[model samples]
Target: MAFVAELSRSVQGRVVLITGAASGIGRATAHVFAREGARVAVTDRAQEDADRVAGEIRAEGGEAVGWALDVADGQAIETVAAAVAERFGGLDILVNNAGTTRVLKIDDGRYDAAWDFLLPILLGSHQRMIRAALPHLRRSEAPRIVNIASTEALGASSPGSIYSAAKAGVTGLTRSLAVELGREGITVNCICPGPIHTGMTAAIPDDNKTIYARRRTALGRYGDPAEVAHAILNFCLPASSYVTGVTLRVDGGLMVRNA
Candidate 1:
């Protein structure tokens, strides 16, 4: 219990909603928040996985609930957000961590694959979630929205052009929304992680992974999901209210590499 208690600076009693809470960074973030005494609403497309994560949190004497919904669907996002607000009484934090990636070349006729996969979860669903939670967030004294973007946003060309574009859009949304919501006492920010070891990267070929390790990262390894979660918590803290409209990179110093 003491171990979990040390994971937070001031997350106690806050109500947090995190999308893509089944696995990877989202799952890790949920655990981190719950450890800090936050009431967490864990949403994922997979009901079983969501339930498992919620159960784990409950077993640890933390407050948590699981909701299953496809973030790609606007209606589903609205329903989930409303339910969270109604159940929790109010919302203090929103983490838009749901996203999909498709590796298709620009010259390929299937360039739309990335857009079709990413638009709903990455851009559309996040927008809907924020809209639905805005009313409740406005009621809170300190409200925060953290959008998970990627380092690919800084470069025009990438392994997946469409994925890069989608991430770029996420960064843009973060800045624009920060301006729009700042007056409402909500601080909006983006986290652009370079190469985190998540389910999304499990399929990366070993040779390609080695090349990435050598050429891109200064730390000589992929980042852990918890590292990124820590950065998110930093942005969500009350002390960070003035630190808005920025993208904090938690990428093991990968952005500094030219190659």
Candidate 2:
């Protein structure tokens, strides 16, 4: 009974700042945390989308605010992080989920462009956001950082090598930061989601998605954004204090299948 009560109140009243919260996994994460009574800062590159999501949360009677944030921009990161910390009184959870995808062959003309564009947003932003939120997180009783990586980090798909590389960097960053901040009782972790139905995959044909998921994922289906969100929520719980430096695969056993 005591354990259940403590777990229930674990994340209530904590301030959570999530990047790319306008849609997909980020949007789902914002809703899940808010449902758990966490005050949420919903940020995205698109100001209107961010506003819309935040508004939806407010309509659901959750505490929230929205901001336009380009994770690739250092100034924007610092500003938004500061504003959210101030608005919510302090930051307790940081979910670095802002990201997009670009696929190009190694020899393609746009390969360099894709590299420059993807690396900063996917890999570099995590570091910058963590740095920006470090001060407030240090002040919180149970600070948690959850970086959203992808299954691409473990296995490669043609023309997505760049994306895979960046995600691999996220896992490495999670481990390094976890070790550095563990002494402070700040838990840093990573989530690697596989074949989630997000905007990035919206263009993929339905038949193709089903075939791919059946072959690659043990669950034989692409996961919903909310499924990944729930995993992120679990890591942010105060009860997860002892779990740090863990790179959890929220991908329905996608990596375990040999066939």
Candidate 3:
């Protein structure tokens, strides 16, 4: 009973705004924050799904609000930021989790259209959302930003060439933002997830996922949403004051040579 209360009060009253909260990692993250008593602002491209997630959180006795947010649209991002701040009175954490996977080859003439569509949601949206939420976040004693990157960022690009490039930019953004925001008591970090089975990966046939897991990951299995959430939650807690500017890979030990 005591443990339960402690867990519940862990992030009590903190305002967390998570983009792409409609499903997958975003939905999982929303549950993580709410379970710990944070007032979560759920925003996604799909308004109905976002609302359902928020409703589920409220039904579970947590505070939350849902808003339709298309990160590709600058104005929509601004509107969501304002609505989130007003709804929660302030914002403490911003999770840039909105992105999509694309199977594209760089040499193909299709590169132009592909880059244009993926860049904004994957890499560009991070800064835009951060700018819109900075004023409110700056007001909080403990502010955090977690950008969701991909393992492809480091690996030689194959399947998602565009996604890989964009995520690499996200990693760069994380480092730069951490250095800049540290003095302001705002910690910035990023996660590189390898083969986490989300809505995106689910589209791939299970046999293919198994083959990839065998080839790439030492753990020989895909991680669950909650597993990634734990790593994210750590950086979010006030206890993580000393930890900043780190790119923690939540992959099941997908080998990427640092040298």
lDDT of 2 by residue, 189-238 (tens): 99999989999999999999999999988999999999999999999998
Q: List ranges where model 3 is wrong by over 4 Å.
A: 1-9, 256-259
**Candidate 1, residue 159: lDDT:** 62
Q: What value does the lDDT take at residue 190 in candidate 1?
A: 95
Better of 2 and 3 by lDDT: 2
Model 1 root-mean-square deviation: 4.8
Candidate-wise lDDT, in order: 0.88, 0.94, 0.88
Better of 2 and 3 by TM-score: 2
Candidate 3 positional error at 105, Å: 1.2
Query: For model 3, which pairs clash?
Result: none
> lDDT tens string, model 1, 66-162?
9997988888888889999899988999999988777777787777765677677778877888998898899887799999989888765456777
Q: Which sections of candidate 2 miss by over 4 Å?
A: 1-9
Q: Candidate 3, residue 21: CA error in Å?
A: 0.8
Models sorted by TM-score, best on top: 2, 3, 1
All predictions: root-mean-square deviation over Cα? 4.8, 2.1, 4.1
Q: What residue runs in model 1 are displaced by over 4 Å at the alpha carbon?
A: 1-9, 206-208
Q: Count the backbone clashes (under 3 Å) in each candidate.
A: 0, 0, 0
